[model samples]
Target: MSEVKKIATRDSYGNALVELAEKYDDLVVLDADLAAATKTGVLKKAYPDLHIDCGIAECNMMVVAAGMSTCGFVPFASTFAMFAAGRAFEQVRNSIGYPHMNVKIGATHAGISVGEDGASHQCNEDIALMRTIPGMVILNPADDVEAKAAVHAAYKHDGPVYLRFGRLAVPVINDHADYKFEIGKAVTLREGTDVTLIATGLPVSNTLEAAEMLAAEGISAEVINMHTIKPIDKDAILASAKKTKKIITIEEHSVLGGLGGAVSEVVAETNAASVHRIGIEDVFGESGPAVELLKKYGLDAEGIYKKVKSFI
Candidate 1:
């Protein structure tokens, strides 16, 4: 077997912004004293005129980005997920979401993968909070390839967008010769008739590995990457549920109102199927190694395989 390549989605986001700045002169990047950690410093280095560090105030950063958007400038705000979604949420809703400002929020270090940051830094409720605000588009890209595409897609969009990214490096899964990304459309990586695995963010690669493990045990599993959490691919999900008869949704977020909750709402209305949610079970994450935390919370490939195996 060949060695797997890994890259952080935050790094990809930073690189994509620089690439986009070359094409769009109206593009501007902003951060709240976390340019180094969020990797937005790459944009600052490449184009200092297009980047700004707003001290340590996340709320003020949102206001500045919103103010720039009204002047025909596309602003991409970068910061930790906790600060972006938890601390400056009202500004995002009032200043941006209310008027539908074209401010793209690149929220990095999301979920329990923020290692030593503990529960206070980890943001597991961002999806749930963003979902409540009307006209807010939420995106959680799976890998570096998808993250790059998502940045471009969000740039073209005309309203508020929240792009969720992680701190840990993950394996590249979309290196196929004919890979393409479409906003609001789910990508089916594998085809099967027994059950369907619907996942977003880092869990996508793990779901694919679980599908491979299930195949060896005489079980055929289908995998779907639901990257756009807000405008979820309902057609793909319902079609898969009708064929597979069973479905499992995975994410690195709380099961209350994350990907699993969004999926269950669709499954319950359109096609009823037994759905199992694999993620943090309404609890806070503690400080530990990223991989170890995944295992303890049953978010790894082995844990996913076991859950699907028992469910089936």
Candidate 2:
């Protein structure tokens, strides 16, 4: 058998976008002139005419991409999540959400993992910001497999899509390549009946480890890998809630409006349960090592385990 080409989700974005551009001529790519850093330049190199470099103006680029989508063109807009979700939010809401435009937002450099780039470049709130937009599809892939699956799913799914990826090269959890991703469905990696640890992005692995620890201590915790933040899997959530009265949410984003908030909202509306959130605090992270920042923000495995235990 031929060896499979391994890929990081960020790199998958560049590769899959190029392949998509080649296959579909109606597909167009728009970048805010940060192609090299975000790897959107790869697609530009493969299909120059199909790529649009909108200088450094993200808001302007969003409006232009919306315009392109209106003309029956599928636009993959690339930019940092901070700018794409923070600066060009209104454009995304009106041009994309209101009209349900098929625009694939390649949001990169999300969370504190953007390391040495400092706090300004880190966008931990992209999920929260985008998920609030009605009709928006929020994506946070754990590894390259989920990333590729996410890309294919986004292409199949219509309406405004915010695809979030990080700068850090995390361990390829989906390395076995059996990673099955669903848009609105959360996957149960480990099933237990004591408690449910719902996680998104890289934190899913941490929650997995924490669940193992909980098991060793005679607590069988259920772990759900929630790759999709918006259009969340309420079915899986309710199932977990019924099985485990104690629920905890872990995310690489701020405690508000991200995975934690999303889970809490569902638990509050449908099923009643206690939810302990493990994520970056509301405070802005300072310049430091990536691992240290994660520990300080309480997103590490130990932190997750501790928080889950506290709730139960």
Q: What is the C-alpha lDDT profile of model 2 across 1-312, one tens digit per residue?
A: 864343345777787787777667788889998888778788888888988899989988988888888898988899888999999999898888888888989998888877777789778888888987999999999877788778778877877789988776665666665667779999888989999889998777777878888888999999998999999998899889998888888888889999989999999997667888888788776677777777777777888778778888
lDDT of 2 at 106: 92
- Model 2 scores worst on lDDT over the 10 consecutive residues at 2-11
Clashes of each: 0, 0
Against the true structure, candidate 1 has what lDDT? Answer: 0.94
**What TM-score, to 2 decimals, does candidate 2 have?**
0.93
Best by TM-score: 1
